[model samples]
Target: MQTGEHPQLQQQLMVQNSSGSLSFNSNLSKEDEEMSRSALSNFRAKEEEIERKKMEVREKVQAQLGRVEEETKRLATIREELEGLADPMRKEVALVRKKIDAVNKELKPLGHTCQKKEKEYKDALEAFNDKNKEKVQLITKLMELVSESERLRLKKLEELSKNIDSLQ
Candidate 1:
């Protein structure tokens, strides 16, 4: 029977010797030799195919990594640009805040001054009203004195006229 047809030939395994050289342990017919050579060739072909696939997978991974790196750089640049955009506004906001604070500082004294002026105005108004009331009272008193003086003068003139007639 041919070695290819023999199940035993396919089952036999190649092994390493003490020195690590691969050697066949079993004595083989010529057919078995040919079968072993065929198996070796098949194994070598499979190994080459695996190496090629490994290289392809590695290249794909490297390409993905490169894309990730590029994206990372772009994101960093965008972040910087965003920060740059905010920087001007941040400075402007700070300046505006300072101006508002300054205005508020100025207004504080003005507010106090306004309150003081209002109090002064109220006091002055009260004084003016009191003076006006006093003037009215004085005018009333003057009118009463004038009325009394006029009554007394009329009575005296009548008495004088009667006395003159009697003397005549």
Candidate 2:
């Protein structure tokens, strides 16, 4: 036996012409050939079964991949809608801020006008009070003049009466 020789060649050499081993006959009966054919058919059936199982697994993986793709598309669409909503919300916030500023702008002038009108009203009230005080003083002076004129007229009448009595 050489170190590098084929194992099948060595086995054949050992098996051939050995009286210690039982050798099979070259001519096989029909029953023996039928047994061989059944074994070959069983091996073919097992291979076909394995191939069918592999095809079923491949189809299942393809279905899972399709579902994953659909889910990914749905998520992407939802993300886009959220982005669109956010943009509008941001714009609405900006518009609200502008409206607040405009309201403040309008209120500032209203407050200033209210303060000016209040000051004008106070000035008018003070002028009216001063005119009323001057009117009261004028009325008091007219009354005093009238009383002095009446006293002079009564003194003249008494002098005339005394002259008449002396002459008589």
Candidate 3:
């Protein structure tokens, strides 16, 4: 007869109760126990599912961390090797520069010597040219003396021929 209570819902609950057919207090405890068992089972299944997901995530993270560690070690080794190789190359470059400096030092005196020799050769060439000019002048004078002697000899011969003709 209450305003909030529904007669149809109360009839449905009464038909579900089991014991004597007309009893108001029936076996509702068994139904409450079954509902509690069902709720507990559902909660346990959900907890198990959550635990499985957590384990899967943990495994993925561990694998990623291991990969990172391996890559870090590989990079470290490569860096060490590069540094090792660079050390010797650095020393070699320094040695080569030293050798080049030594060569430059050695060449400076040789360059000065070569320049002095070239100057001496030019002076010698100039002296030889002056001597050649004097020799050419002497040769010209000798040629003129030989020509005058030949002319005098021809005049003497002509005079002798004339004297002989007069005697005849």
Candidate 4:
């Protein structure tokens, strides 16, 4: 055998005549050929079974992924519905708060005006009471002056009458 030459598998063929020589035949024995074929057939069957099982597993995984996708979509829809349900109340609360702010804005100026008008009414009432008191004082003074004038006139009339009787 050479250093780089690989050994070959063969059967020796025996010749009956022709100097009874032996020659290497390239084909294997019948029993060895049958065994090799049976082993190759078994390997092919196992490969086919593995491939079928792989396909089944792949299909199952794809189905599970599809179901997960659908569930995720449903969860998203539910979240949207929940947000929708809460939005109206938020809007209503915001509107009510705005109305309250507007009312407070109106009330501030009105309250100031009411206070101003109340002070004016109080000043007017005080002035009216002062004028009434002044009127009462003036009436008392007039009554005193009338009484003095009447007494002086009656004394003059009696003096004049005595003078006229003496002359006659």
Candidate 2 lDDT at 150 equals 75
lDDT of 3 by residue, 1-168 (tens): 232433443453445443335332344356544543454456568879999999999999999999999999999999999999999889989999999999999999999999999999999989999889998998888888777777777788778888889889
- The total of clashing pairs for model 2 equals 0
**Superposed Cα deviation of residue 79, candidate 1 (Å):** 8.0
Clashes per candidate (backbone, < 3 Å): 0, 0, 0, 0
- How many pairs of residues in model 3 come into backbone collision? 0
Better of 2 and 4 by TM-score: 4
Off by over 4 Å in 3: 1-86, 161-168
Candidate 2 segments whose C-alpha is farther than 4 A from its true place: 1-97, 160-168
Residues 24-140, candidate 2: write the lDDT tens digits.
345545654454455446656887999999999999999999999999999999999999889968988999999999999999999999999999999999999999899889888
lDDT of 1 by residue, 1-168 (tens): 553454554444333322456666467667677777787677678889999999999999999999999999999999999999999899889999999999999999999999999999999999999999999999999999899888899889999999999999
Worst 10 residues of 3 by lDDT: 16-25
Q: Residue 113 of model 4: what lDDT?
A: 97
List the global CA lDDT of all models: 0.83, 0.75, 0.74, 0.72
**How would you encode candidate 4's per-residue C-alpha lDDT over 106-143 as one tens digit per residue?**
99999999999999988998998999899889887877
